[model samples]
Target: MTKVLLAGESWMTHSIHVKGFDSFTTSAYHEGGTEMIAAMRAAGLDVTYQPAHIAADHFPLSAEALAAYDVVILSDIGANTLLMPDRTFARSEPTPNRLRLIADFVKGGGGLLMVGGYLTFQGIEGKAAYAGTPVDDVLPVALMTRDDRSERPEGVVPAIVNGAHPVMAGLTEWPTFLGYNRSMLREDATLLAEVDGDPFIAVRTVGSGRSAIFASDCGPHWGPPAFLAWPGYGPLWANLCNWLAG
Candidate 1:
């Protein structure tokens, strides 16, 4: 089985509840990668999901630790989470740069995939902030310095530019996505699919490894219920994971 380590796609929200007389705060947690994870596992891939907070402290900081998986996925997570662990952030202790470790892992023959979301690639208000990081350097597309999300509440259709690519295998039709990140395709990268003429799915070979980017969320918001219900949904993710593991 292809071993995959998926990080991010989870978040906590705190809201203030005000009733004319008083106000109280409430907090809730949510995850967005449930469907995607199930799909990969159903396809026989060994998947380990690390929510944003958990990943912030536990994501591999060494190449040897990362080597345990064939593919590493970053989805809906910002750079700061991985860049600053408890030791580094609270104790002011030096730690290995996790972003560089991921980049090096890919170059050493591991696969890397980044799934888009509100906190993925130069996300909302540019809070994701992955523009010039080492992770950005190995991606098949170039991220924008500012907020890159192109909100399409009206929805947009994705066009498969390279349907023949293995990553798109068994995928014929696609459901509309609410929105996606807009990115520039690299010269050597393969544009497998696109939305609004911008890269939606792209891949590239980096040294002895491979990397791919899905400019839209894998589950909600961008990937609406209609998309998650699409028959090809499972196969699409399965294909991407398998192709990357290759």
Candidate 2:
């Protein structure tokens, strides 16, 4: 059984009765982290889910407590949630950062997978800016900016780049994704899948550990239902977990 740690915002309350386009009360939508955990567990992997409800003050503590899992999944959360007041750009020179700690964890042999959302990788309006952070160095691809998100109303078609990679083994084409965070890739990165000439899925090796970045959301509202209903979902995520653990 592979032990995995998942962290991200869980408690979200939307404001109600906002005038025109935004007329509704505080409602909670299912998050991606929980969805991934369920998929992993259904594949027989032992998963430990740690959701950061009020993330603004809980991420640093959660990052520091990630030693127990074989892999870590960061979904729908951004940089500001992990930055302590003292570590903000206004106060320090960006030394001894939490992002660095995550990089070090991977370098010291930890697996990591980052999923996309409105708050991931230079997210909408530059929310979860990860370009210059230590997390960027460990990723197989390059993140351009958070505001560069791509919305595919007709959804995207994914094509496998390396069918032989362990993470991709036993899998064919994946289901269409509704949207994704746009990102550039480093020369050393391996492109796994693409959509309209853009890289949709990618992976890279960092020291003894490995990391993968799926630029699309794995949750229901963002990804196709086939991702969870199809037979391939189990093996797809299983392969990812096994590769990351190695």
Best model per lDDT? 1
Candidate 1, 58-172: lDDT as tens digits: 9998999999999999999999999999999999999999999999999999999999998988999999989999999999999999999999999888998998889888887
Model 2 accuracy (lDDT, Cα): 0.74
**Candidate 2: stretches off by over 4 Å:** 9-11, 18-30, 54-64, 85-96
Clashing pairs in 2: 16-24, 16-25, 122-146, 123-146
Instruction: Sum up the clashes in candidate 1.
Output: 0
Q: Cα lDDT of all candidates, in order?
A: 0.93, 0.74
| Per-residue lDDT of 29 in model 2 | 58
Give the per-residue lDDT digits (tens) of candidate 2, residues 103-153.
Answer: 888888888888887777778888788878888889887888548688887
